[model samples]
Target chain A: METMLRKREDKIAIIGAGTIGLSFAALHLLKHPTCSIAIYDTRPDVHDYVAEYMSKTLAGAGVDIDSTMQRLRISAYLQEAVLDAVIVQEQGPENLDFKITTWAEIERYAPKTALFWSSTSGIPASQQSRNMQDKTRLLVVHPYNPPHIMPLLEVVPSPRTSQAVIDETLEYWRGIGRTPVVIKKECTGFVANRLAFALFREACSLVTQGVIDVKDLDEVVQNSMGPRWTVAGPFKSYHAGGGDGGLKSFLNKIGGTVQQCWDASEKDVKKGSIAVGEDWQIEVCRQTDEAYGVVDTRERDTRTRSVLEAVSCEEEVQ
Target chain B: METMLRKREDKIAIIGAGTIGLSFAALHLLKHPTCSIAIYDTRPDVHDYVAEYMSKTLAGAGVDIDSTMQRLRISAYLQEAVLDAVIVQEQGPENLDFKITTWAEIERYAPKTALFWSSTSGIPASQQSRNMQDKTRLLVVHPYNPPHIMPLLEVVPSPRTSQAVIDETLEYWRGIGRTPVVIKKECTGFVANRLAFALFREACSLVTQGVIDVKDLDEVVQNSMGPRWTVAGPFKSYHAGGGDGGLKSFLNKIGGTVQQCWDASEKDVKKGSIAVGEDWQIEVCRQTDEAYGVVDTRERDTRTRSVLEAVSCEEEVQ
Candidate 1:
């Protein structure tokens, strides 16, 4: 793999130098020790950001920082970045018009055969590729926050995306040490965020209604579902929870309670009814700040890395 | 703690030797190696169940099985079980009538000063203590499944429960190596399950909606929010995700997207509308079984323990 990456054919273009873009650059550089990375960004501080990222992730990269720096080149022009790349990863702005224009220009400049992977959290490939002449190879490969650390990527393809490209995209993410789950159908927010924010909304409601405070809610979750889901997902946990009857029995037994909560959910999770500066919102944020604001993010990053390493390889459900 | 537990007065009674009951006994015995426990249950197989539980958790308990067993005494009568217990932990059936009658009887037989703790998952202390002459000390002490290892104990006090007892209960659980979160107000399902099931219902909707499959959803969660929440709960994560703006900014930024999901949520999480024996239920169960059935629960338990141990002591908030 190292020898193969040394070839010019292995060059990959990164079409943004923001947090996600730089993270993708750093990790990809770490992943393939000999591969070249071309990062394109109009930001004046793009080079400084890359330097700062290197200093933070240097020890973890397990390779010479100088060579990585040598291999990484910044391009002001998008044409220079995608000139001879095998894969083009676009982590540009989330605006729809911006994405359409950028992708169209990327297609015109880059090799026609290059894989177009957009790291858009919410945008679907269908809309992102609308302005492109040939949308055959374009797709959405959305990662969780801090793309380099979190391995999950939502691989969503436009209807025009070729089946071969989808398979290759999944293969590429896996080869890069990512756990990619292909979305069979595209929708807003995808799977993880929809599930995450759904739970978060209910939690907000609980805190607002004075059922439980923010810090206690955090502790309750950390000690319970946080670790449980880290081991197995919802269906697996519910199935195992059912004893012998599986999910059917679990539903029959606990479904009513869940339903009761759901019935009362409207009182808590108002349909997008979060007034940004509301009193409850202010108090909850203050509580969170008091409780968790003390712990620096470095500690969190360490915790995240340790927890991910401990359980990521233990998936029972393929 | 060991020397303190050796006293004759440091005795606790465990009522009902079902799965939860036995697990509680094992962990308590492990937590206080020299403390005595009296277990009472109507099941003829109760002793066998304890013996099996000891065998399973023996290595993890780090105490001599012989000594632990000697300290644990199973009684046929509730009167004998609560004879000289400093605390009475009732893990009886979920039936409300059974709890009301049992608590009344326990109050009559046990020392009037014994701390009353009910391990009822849903039945609140308010309901469980209906027939008790004195409900001052009684409160709901609910644990996540396999109570010994998963350290979450929801310490809920009824409207009548004394504040001193609530504080004492939280301290006791913490001493037993459990992460106790005080539920400020009593509500059905409490904090953890409500948050868990809320997230779970949305996951169900996503799977049923054909947006993602069961196993891939597991992978997505295991890779994303599962590990994330393990580090910091939803509030902290969002607060950090907002860059400099905190959760208020986070709400303003992604609030619209979250609301969009919430608006569409009803079509999926239809007020606990899970048909227990429906086609989706059967198919999902089949998929779960096919995916996770082959992996024996021992593996899951081990995974749960490791993940819990990795993050339990790292709480940023008290």
Candidate 2:
């Protein structure tokens, strides 16, 4: 009766349906209503919980829950799930040994045309798929925490990954409303966390030295560069700093100092100096105290949801 | 008669009634209604323009204008302005020679008790006050661009700055609804910019290598680290990354990769690379033609203003 029955080839399979995997399946179904999604997990009943959560979320967001659910299915076996899929999103544990074993299995079972992506953050795709005969089809698509809400998806390629695979994966990521930044040259942790941790190391160094308290250190970023960085990156900020002439002018005047300071900051990755001192009693703290921590987290979550909703509704408005 | 009729003991002299100087004066007046503010500038009718702008801003924000203005008074000569002032906020041009001359003159005329603070991002406070006789009282209070809207003020003390001076300046900065993060050890661009640029240098390097484009580079920060950095610095981000264990667990898990990848990236900071190209306009065209050239600049500016406004209001509410 409908044209939908004719195009069943566009299918997605999600392996190891944990938090990241379930989120990917839900989001894929949300974006591609006509495309089917089959989720595989070692544990039973996790799919039921995921399905329930998705239905509630869709209802909360005023989306069509029945239609969204119609495109989603579940399987207990990865071999049966990914046999005819267009893409396979793997979200197994971060342990390297486990990933290597699973990835090799994925390479054996997944269709040749399917673009397989591992949601691993620390492990490089190259190392995981080294023994696979057709490793070029595999890449790392690491998403941030609460993957459904946060938009960053680090698309890192292995040395063997083809250009077409990267381009197709990029298209898939964008189509699903995720902000994907491709790592042309793959390195562990890709770009964001490495750069971030460098700053973290310096902040810890200062805090350890008693230069400032923890709260004040957070304030420094929240009120200062954090706001500016939301709009532009560091290079552009320096460009504006040069006032009229841009980066060249800024470096010409402050280049020596920048270099000197950078040299001083260089150190091998050190362990964190501070440790959580005690376990807190939830009963001792009042509702207000608990609410305070939740307030900031909730606000950030709301902002994220708003951004995603805006992106999804853009076409309708146009 | 009330105590309001009595003359205030503490006075602040603002050297150069530019945007920053005037905003500092207004902010101080808002906090301490009775504190005397005497502004000095070579430019004629500058105070009048500042006064007009402040009135409009205050009115828009539902603040009292005339009463606030009563705390402020402008003078034409530097000597007449700094006669009895306890703090001198120097917002002069960003030139080494100008700063050297200005500091020397301020040291010559101002009382021995007066502390001099330069609002310079480019010149280190140590370098600027190298020749001053009372360099111990000289420090740098480098605020973010458009100082009035931002609350981050980097209080960088020179080698000669006394403990007393730093403490008093910290008190003064806090009294005006501002947060001051001390630079216990001074380096180029202080803390925020140096950390910011380190990331920027890597981004440029990635682009130059054709690993990632300009737009994707921005997306990586926003979706991943940028939003989190708004609430927490890198240390805390990693701390949370540990899931429940905090920083120690996070680093322990990722420590190997961090060390491996620390040396993975090249550390050279060059001018605009071929990836970004010399002209950002042409580079943007190659990356994303729709948002290239003039349209990109306008979009960036609009986004910048929006973020600034959003964060300012959010902080105020908190």
Candidate 3:
């Protein structure tokens, strides 16, 4: 019933200081510098690991190291991490049983009103919170990898999730400079992954069908659809393509072709068909590292940050 | 065979000075300042229309107006347009009969060695060149909309297309600051459209399924996968996700989820099924315009150009 806007002094707790959790911590620290954070992980040396990880990745990503470090707290105990928190973000492994156990523990420690957010990309909140006493407090706040750089957060709520919790989560993410889309229904892979894997299925099919090499397929995407989609989504892009006529005209012109192509796409996405060979996998990894460097480099991170800033600024102006 | 690199003074002829043709001309002129261009269109007022279109669009895209104008020439006669062209790029309407007649005229006027490129996004060169005497010189060089800004050029060669033509086309595109990916096999919609539509199908399905709205779905993509894909394609992105273990490890972890999502995507892209309501379409177009402005604005165009420059520079350094 209270205002959905997140307060600057909100105590946020992060569970499981793995790659996703660490990345989330860095991003939260960087964006919400005034907020307090407590990180919890079962690993004995998670404190040292997280401190070192944050120092290296955050500094490389051009964050203010001293302030971010000042705001962060590491706790080996889950209760210590979540007891007084306003928002408890769980970043545990992608197992239903593990997530259910984590949520149950979080529910026991955190206040009934505390927002429970999970970073599960595929597992829905309903399944994750099946064992929890109060499911209304829990929802999925899934982020893309390297969360510090990528700005998407799919805020998926279960059927029993409270309206207030959903509203607060949406505003909370936006407050921290994230573009969060609330998934109306719990779906596997959510929207982002569904769209991504759809394209991937076709890319894999093309590679297997010998229509294009792996490297060339990557090039085709990076050069064309990637940039265009970055500026505008499929609907907007097609709307622009309609010239002055907009989406209607564009669809009228190319709807048939789209259907034809969809029909031509590989029907079954088996493990064998999607596989890009071991050599190709290794080669692509090497090429990717060579191009963008590992994790969050200054160049790659800065570019994404600048674009995000630009988009946000444009939104504010409009 | 003679060093596939394109000379600055290469005479390029542009057929059908419509939207795609004009965009290609602006990009070619901006990127290859010394290249001379001849434009031919059947419309009586095409010369004036194209001239005004180029001046407005190119200037907004931050191109050097004087040089672009200096290198461009408008001709109503087909022979005059194709006479001494090293490359004749046809941007005619997506009509097989129209393309066939146009290519026939081009082949009759142009020299045997002149490379023929069509900006047909759907129609394959083989189909268009059916009526031509020499099909080896003809191929598809499809660019995403607003070709001046988007760096992708799908260089599709038919079975009859010569190796020399393919190589020279690749080099020519590179010389003009475009990323060219050779689509080895001729399939409808080629690579880019096939991938775009695959994603679009899922997007449409999601909208229809009430999982997300049109605008929210666009935000999810532009904020997350868009920027991520801009830096790395799906294969490279997944490879990075695999961490030290690489894509193999990533697949081992989430390949099942990917298959599930792929299965969930809409199998058929029928016109009625894919259609978002007319009101929604208009609302999306209006929102897009408010965000990026209409067509080729200075802000949107410059943003795209800078991103392209940054990517190319990174590639060079790597």
Among these predictions, the greatest TM-score belongs to: 1
Q: Best-fitting candidate, measured by lDDT? A: 1
TM-score of 3: 0.89
Error of 3 at B95 (Å): 2.3
Model 3, span B119-206: residue lDDT tens:
9988999999999998888899998877887888999999999998999898888776778888999987888888888888788777
Q: Which of the two candidates, 2 or 3, achieves a greater TM-score against the reference? A: 3
Q: Under CAPRI classification, how is model 3 graded?
A: acceptable
What C-alpha lDDT values do all the predictions have?
Answer: 0.81, 0.67, 0.78
Please provide, for model 2 over A172-241, each residue's C-alpha lDDT reduced to its tens digit, 9 standing for 90 to 100. 7776667888887775467776666556545654455445555556668876666566656665556555
What tens digits encode model 1's per-residue C-alpha lDDT throughout B1-318? 333345655788999888888888888888876578899999888778788877787766567778778888889899999987878999988899999999999999898667899998789899888988888879988989888778889999999999878877776776667789889888878888888888877887788777888899998888888888888888888888876777767788777787777667766655435444445666666777777664456678788777766665454432
The local lDDT score (0 to 100) that residue B149 gets in candidate 2 is 55
Q: Candidate 1, residue A302: CA error in Å? A: 0.8
Say which docking band candidate 1 falls in.
medium
Evaluating just chain A, the predictions reach TM-scores of 0.92, 0.79, 0.86
Candidate that would win on DockQ: 1
lDDT of 1 by residue, A133-168 (tens): 998879998889887788889999988999988888
The regions of model 3 sitting more than 4 angstroms off are A1-9, A61-67, A266-303, A306-318, B1-9, B61-67, B266-299, B313-318
Which residue pairs overlap in candidate 2's backbone? B239-B247
